[model samples]
Target: MIAARILDPDSKLATTRWWSTTTLPDILGVNDADEDDLYDAMDWLLQRQSHIEKKLAARHLTEGGMALYDLSSSYFEGTTCPLAALGHNRDGKKGKLQVNYGLLTDDRGRPVSVSVFKGNTGDPKTLMPQVRKVKDDFGIKTVVLVGDRGMISQKQIDEIKGVDGLDWITALKTDAIRKLADDQGPLQLGLFDERNLFEFTHPDFPGERLVACRNPELRKLRAYKRKSLLEATSLELTKVRAMVGRGKLAGKDKIGVRVGKVIDKYKVAKHFVLNIKDHHFDFHIDTEKVAAEAALDGIYVLRTSLAEERISTEDIVRNYKNLSQVERAFRSMKTMDLKVRPIHHRLENRVRAHIFLCMLAYYVEWHMREAWRPVLFCDEDQARKKTRDPVAPATRSKTALEKVHSKTLADGSTVHSFQTLLKQLSTIVRNRCRVPTDGPNAPIFDVVTTPTVEQQRAYGLLETIEV
Candidate 1:
């Protein structure tokens, strides 16, 4: 089933029967497992997830290696599963019941372990369990837990400090960054023009070092986004103001509600000050507030327990940015490549089993992506270029590579994405041909479809030999 998931990601278990009997039996050299077998196997695997995850960590993770952690949610269609509940839906299905799950990955973004929690679990609360799992179950000593700011609160930080040989790397929230800037005086943009990173310490967060980073490109993008939203919001607000002046909107509450809709639509409510009274409504752009925010537009602060002498600022930024790797994994698990939802499982254990199966499938897909990079649009090499600091975010490189790879090939042929390539592989079929009543035996044997040149090339890239 895991292999079926990787080979045909869009397929469900019932659809695997034909592929398994026709093709997989020849490749894997076994009788086709039925849907029930797959479900039972999933249940068995879920029961041993703890042991399996430990073995995975022992095999791939090293002591003191950085563990990147993050949380994602998937919606459930039915309400039968005990684990499904209303919560913060990362999948954007706000009214749907969902389950929150956290994934732990190694420094290179190989997933080591995953845990399912109730749908409403807060991101910060998910950290300690994962940290303990890394320390106690995986037996990884001197580990650095890297996550986004939402994963680590001040209380979580204090809890992490109590753990021996356990360190953390996470970014500060916008509020914390503002307070840091306030305490240190206004952050001079000229300093960032010379160098993008600066190190500082504050009494509020003792024993932790802060790395301030500025990206000029991010600054320009943020400024542009803010200006565009402000203009659009102003237009909407102006219409409301006209309505109020013309006496179309009489009550203060009605005018406030109209203004609120515009503010919410643009999501620039904080940048404007709105005043509403009986038969009067007006809004003024908060220039001072906007300026303050603009000053920190491209700036971000990373907080880590690693000592300054032990790690370079560039390395800190690079490691912190690897959180994007886990995020990428989540994207792969969700709608991007592997659609792990509209989950059909209604039992609690079955839900867990389904998620665990997807994780295992992704474990294989991750390696396949690396092996098949020559034929795919992957930037693993470009991302590791040593000519300059790789500390900058890799999002741009990934997007550029996606565009480059999706274009026509050098031979004027269409390029195949990873998913499309898999679809091509699925075309290779095994046929059961019956010999015409030879003697009395009436023997039958299976014949595999001859591989196309493109399929052969894909198999060669993946180092998979056709049976």
Candidate 2:
């Protein structure tokens, strides 16, 4: 199943037909497996999920280490599955049922375990169980949890504080940051004159530190996007006003509803002032509101329970930023490689097992990418990443940039993406050969194609990996 997902993702029915064309069935010792067999296998895997997760946790997680947790949802195809419901749709599949799941990974973003939840489950609702899973099930005592603001809200933080041996690093929501930047608040624009990152504290968050960051580039980008959205919203609202003027649109209720749709579509209602009457409709940008919002653009504050002695301020920000790695894992599972979305499984356990299978496949792919970094277009100087500015946007190293511009390694060999490299290796195949005259009575032998130098190089890198 992992091989099928990594190689080419499709429906299970297609997988049954697909595997026969490859050596996966032979390699996995499931040559005669049918669709029923695959479904039954998924059920079997789901039964052992807890045991499997414990083993992975033991391998990847350590006491006092950071565990990255994030929740994402995938749209489901059928409504029969109990886990599927209309919830926060991250995939932008309107009017589609989805199943929410949270991924837990170690500090380096190596996936340790995943838990599937009902589609309607709130993000914070999934946190405490994982905290228990790490401390109770995985037997890790003194661990730090890193999650996004939505996943670790103030309510969740209060709950986490009650638990011993558990620490957390998460950012404040936009509203919270806005409060911090208020006239008397600690987060002042002047604080960033010397450095982009500044650490301060508030009495509200006792025994915690807040690291405020300001990225000028991000600020500019946000300003541009806001201007664009405001313009777009204005353009749409103008059409509505024109309709009201031409008598095509009338009535106070109708004008308000039309204006509501326009503001909601762009989600910049706060920046607009609307006036509507029985026969008149007009809207204008509230410049003051826009400037207030623009003041907070590209400014975010990270909150962490860990102390400066245990972890530095920069490291705390970096750990919070590591949540992007989990995001990358989600991207790979959902669309890039695994194609875990639009699930058709009706059984809840089947859905859980399918997601687990995709996670396991990602585990393998992550290792392969790490091992093949020298040959692929991945940066080799990873140590630089650890030492670089945690708040600044990541930039590629000179060596990595060279590979990008030249499209080759030092040996002048072509650099390939992870997918293309795998495709290249797939060309090496095994065939059963026998002379025509001796085919009836002779013993057949497998003839494997000799790998090319490039294939050998790739294989050599992977030889050290222990599956």
Candidate 3:
């Protein structure tokens, strides 16, 4: 099941047909197994999920270490699964039912465990159970949890505060950060002039450290995006105004409805002011609001319970930004690498099992990526990631850029993406042969194709890792 997901992801029925053409049937000793057998195996896998997750947690996690947690929802294809419910659709599949699942990973973003929740479950509501699982199931005590602002809101942080030996690192929400930059707030814009990062404290958050960072590049990008959105919204509003002027669109209700669509489409309603009267409509950019928003463009505040003596400000920001790793995992699972969406399972447990299987498959892929970095397009100089300025946007190493431009490794081997590398490996085949002079009952022999130099290099690299 895992091999099918890793090599060529598909539904159980499709997987059965696909794997039959490979050597997996003979190698894994499931030559006669059908789709039913695979489903039964999923059932069996679900029963042992806790045991498997516990083993994973033991391997990657440690006491007083940091763990990253995040939740994402995938759209469901069928209506029968009870876990599927209508709620926030991250997959952009409007009106579709989805199931939310929380992923817990080590500080480096190696997936440790996954828990499924109803689609309607809020992000903050999923935090407590994972905290309990890490502490109770995984036996990791005194751990620092890292989550995004949405996941570790004030209410969730309040709950986590009561738990002994539990701490967290998360950014302040936009509103919270805005309040910090208010006239009377402790945060100062001048602090960032000398350096992109600075630390400060406020009475509102006692005994917790706040790390403020401003990325010039991020600030400029946000400014550009906001300008584009404002212009687009204005253009649409101008069309509506023109319609109202030409008598093509009249009535206050009609004009208001048309204006609302433009505002919602661009989502820049806050930066615009509108006036709609009978057969008249006019709108203007709210410059004050736009300037206020742009002032905090590249700025963000990270809040953490750990003291400076425990973890540095740079490390805190880097750890919070590592949530991108979890996002990458979700992209791979939902899109192509695993095909975890469009779930065919009607039973709730079956759906859970399917997601768990994909998580396990990703766990293997993560290790493969780390081991195959020498030959892949991935950057090999990971040590710099920890030492570089966390506030600045990440840049690829010089060696990595050369590999991308040259399309080959230092030894003249070609570079490959993870998917294309797998395709290259699939060319090796095992053949059955018999002597022509022998009788019909003659013994058959197996001959496996010799791997190419590059394929052999890949195999040799993977041999050193124990995924």
Candidate 4:
């Protein structure tokens, strides 16, 4: 199954059967296994998933290590499975039944465990079960839990604080930030001009430190986005107003619904004040509200239980930002790479088994990418350089252009991406030859293909020899 994920990520069960019979046997040096074998193996793994997760945690996690948690949803086709229901669809598949799953990863972005939950499960509710698993199932002590704002609640924080030797690192929500910035708040625009970060404490959040960070480039980007959205909203409002002036629209309820849509379309309803009377409709932008929101354009607050002396503010920001690693893992499991979607399994266990298989496949791919960095395009080395401009997001070339297709290694040999290198290695094939029959059950001879130097070097990085 791992090999199928690496070689044919977008494959379904039928395609996997073909691969096992044809391509996989040559590479793995084993007899062809049927689709039943695959299905049985998945069921067996699902039955022992808990034990497997504990073993993984024992091998990869340690005391004081960071455990990052996040949730993602995938849509299902039918309603036969009990896990499938209408809920928050992260995949943008509205009106479709979906299943939600939580993924827990180590600080290095390697997946440690995953849990399947009902589609209607809330993000904050998923954290406690994972917390229990980390403490009770994995038997890990003194580990910090890292998550986004959606995954951590005030109640959850209180619960985590009660646990001995467990800490949390999370960001504050927008409303919480606004409350912190009330009268004589610690966050001020001027403080950002002198330095990007400031440290403070809040009465409500006792025994915790807050780190406020500002990005000038992010401020400019937000300002531009706000202006564009406001303009679009204004244009929409003008159209509605003209309709009212021309006597095309009437009735208070009708105008209210129409104006509501205009404001909702651009998501700037809070910035606009709508007035509706009999046969009259008008709207105006609340400049004070707009300015107040603009003041917080680039500001973000990170709350943590760790003391300033234990971990620097910069390191705190870096660790919080690493939540993007979990996001990247989701992207890989979704459309970005692994395409673990459009689930057709009807049984609940089968659905869970399918997602589990995808997670396991991703685990193998994660290690493979790290081991084959010399022949693959790794983003870690270039991440710092890419973040030099805070406003612009980093981008990599989707298609290799002729000018920058290959990279030159220290030995002066050209290397390609892992996918491209795999394609190069696929040229080596095994041939079967018939030898003269010495006895009744004579063994047949097999001739192995000679691997090119490039294939040899690529395999060498993985600490394996070409077959």
- Per-candidate Cα lDDT values, in order, are 0.81, 0.92, 0.92, 0.80
Model 2: per-residue Cα lDDT at residue 295? 90
- For model 3, residues 265-322, the per-residue Cα lDDT tens digits are 9988989989999888998999999999999999999999998899998999998998
Q: Write the per-residue lDDT of candidate 4 for residues 307-367, one digit (tens) a residue.
A: 7777776767777777888898888887755667888888889889888888988888777
Q: List candidate 4 stretches off by more than 4 Å.
A: 10-12, 26-32, 379-415, 432-448, 464-467
lDDT tens digits by residue: candidate 2, 155-226: 999988989999999999998898889999999988788999989999988999999998888999999999
TM-score attained by model 2:
0.98
TM-scores of all candidate predictions against the true structure? 0.90, 0.98, 0.98, 0.88
Ranking by lDDT: 2, 3, 1, 4
Instruction: Give stretches of model 2 more than 4 Å off.
Output: none
Better of 1 and 3 by lDDT: 3
Best by TM-score: 3
RMSD list, candidates in order:
3.3, 1.3, 1.1, 4.1
lDDT by residue (tens digit), candidate 1, 1-467? 67766655543455555564445655676465666776787789999999989988987788777889999999988888889889987877879999989999888788989889889889999999998898899888888889998998788998889899898899888997887677455445566777888887878788888889988788899999999999999998999899889989979888888888888888988999988998899889999999989989988988899987777777888888888889888898887766688777888888887788888878888888877765666554645643346445445365446548566544554556788888887788778888987586788898888998777877776775221
Q: Estimate the lDDT of model 2.
A: 0.92
